[model samples]
Target: MAGIYIFSDRADIAAEIVGFARAAGKEAFVMALGEEAAQALTNAGADKIYAIDGDSELIESYAKDIAEFLIKAGAELFAVGATPRGRDLAARVAGYLDCAMASDVVSVEYHDNQLTCVRMLYGGAVQEKQVLSGLSVVTIPAGKFEPAQGESTIEALKLKADTRVSIVETAPIVKEGVDLSKAEKVVCVGMALDKEEDLQIARDLAAVLGAELGCTRSIAEERHWLPVESYIGISGAVIKPRLYISMGVSGQIQHVYGIRDANLIVAIDINEKAPIFKAADYGIVGDLYEVVPLLTEALKK
Candidate 1:
């Protein structure tokens, strides 16, 4: 019988994919690339864990070789997290296997010996359903499905070959603050601020709420008010914050696409008719300059 295979650099996400496969009533297996990956995957719902002994740098370089392994193992459906690197690896694997592939899949269903998926399109303005013909590959977006839970059988796989790309040294990107992807709460701003001085109010609000400060592409790339890392959009970071508060943002599709998974969206804008209100759970029709300080103070109490 063809089985489900999940590839993740992250054990948590791999477990989640395993959960998805189990929900489809198929055998779920995870390919993990670290010492503790097998145990972690088992705890998360994997039926079997294929532990590849390697660091992230090595595994990433072996994306193609991993695909070869999947093809030999006869994985009917292969899945990965829809992060940037995940997408790239999945595409490369699909190319190597010459199979139909999908990216940023929001939902997956097993049907008639094949897989069907719902995914975002056109900067997330539409959700499209796609069915794969054979040997399917997919990228599962975060927050779409809760992580799967169960214990798994552990197996070890060793890469007997090496790739051209090798990591001589590795250094983490030093950020001065919290990683936005992991932040549960975020306060994002748009073009409403007339000057750089207005950013302090946004920062103050974020501080009060103990949230990360984010912005649209314009604010980060065009206006240079924030770093590129702070930008949330299709070409930037994708966040699933519990509470996403927006100020001065007009709610463009590219910007709104990033926050589609947010639990509660609060929009503060001068324009009541702005597109943001349509997407927000709570909205304030007023100047952010006058409103943000008040909201910050209220939270401070």
Candidate 2:
């Protein structure tokens, strides 16, 4: 019987599931698309590798085969990353297994034949805990768990590929930003900034603190000052940094949800009653245009 099965085209995310499986007190068996993915995941600590060694136009073409194989193997839990491709594969597998599935699960525990899952609802405004009985599936976002390392054996699986779908062309979108989910310190800007040029103040502070730059939804979507990848919120990147600093952010609940786990939060805004102050450990009620430069200088000295 398979303990817990994990799947992701990306080895790093699969390794994260490996960490999650081990933390939940189960051995991890991961689905590897090709030989390299299998060996890379095993090198990263997966105990068992369900190796699907072949070249295909698309990895998702094997979803049907994977679902059937796991069901026949008496798979207990199927954990998948919440990437676009991962979500599609997870839904297809759940449909085939005829089992309940949880999406964007932040936490899960398996104890005494029970699987309890915790996921946020209403854009981080609420958390719902559910218990699923027998052969369930779940999708989790990255950066939730640290990657685990171990030794593992590979089991070869040959699947019938889907002939219906074919890729015509592929082009990766160019993005300029760090993966904020993994950053230890983050400096975020918000709508309080009136112009793109004003981001320099936030950047200066980030450079001094050795932190990555982040932004609220408006700064990225509405203003186009930063890439969507730089946004931090329920709809964007959720982060848990050791130190999080916000400039000119009004601190809506959606934005706060992303940084709530930070070890320390500091907010700088002109309004004394800005909501960001409520969620911050330290609130500076002053114009960010004046406050940030001074703070950066102080940190330098």
Candidate 3:
């Protein structure tokens, strides 16, 4: 039987992985970073839960400790969410274990003593199925699977390890407004915005709607209109929001990669042939200079 590990901060996701493991008739373990998170995983039906104990101040050191424990536990398949922290932790663990690692996997199945993983590539343009060899580490995309449910026994295990490093300092980066990752609504602008003055129209709409502002690579990197961190594309941030408003975005494959998880996509571009129209739930063919200001005014009043 294969051993599955659920790596997550949220109990609900851990529960889903537990359900998947039970369905596959595999022994599952939940690894969390905190006590409260561990209990939540236990409630979700993990057979075993391992909580890493340390000051929240030393994240890298704690991650290394957890990685070592997972390797020693003989976990056959390690799974983590594709979130920023999850990705970093998984990579570190995989590197330590000297195993192959895959990211953005949406589904996994084991048959005939081999684990098959399905992942999305090229901004959701293609699905690739890979059969991992040896010990495998995988980072699953969020919101792709259901959490485990039902009554199950939970056991907390204690692990001992030596710390090789210590945290020297910590500081928070202060910024005004909401983080784009946590924003409920997002307004994205693209190269089709034409002149820099037109960007104000998009910003005004975002302010009126209480939404975070995002842009494609061209607008952010080339024009320097938005910060590089605000670029949303395959090479940038992957966002899943309740509402995503696209203004003058042509919807290139790279840009679409980041917004595939949006529940609602509204695309506005004068070019009806723009690729984004195909993915948009609502499409408007018009000049963004006129369309955006009208939208801003409408949203304001």
Q: Highest lDDT, which number?
A: 2
Q: Report clashes for each candidate as comma-separated counts.
A: 1, 2, 4
Residues 25-70, candidate 3, lDDT per residue (tens digit)?
A: 8888877765666665656777777766655533344555666666
* Clash list (residue pairs), candidate 3: 15-148, 16-147, 16-148, 19-148
Per-residue lDDT for 246 in model 3? 94
Error of 2 at 197 (Å): 2.8
Which candidate has the top score in TM-score?
Answer: 2
Ranked by TM-score from best down, the candidates are 2, 1, 3
Q: lDDT tens digits, residues 148-179, model 2?
A: 98788888878887768888999997778889
Candidate 1 lDDT tens digits, 58-131: 55565677777887888788888876677877888888788999888878887775688888898899999988
- Count backbone overlaps in model 1: 1
Error of 1 at 152 (Å): 3.7
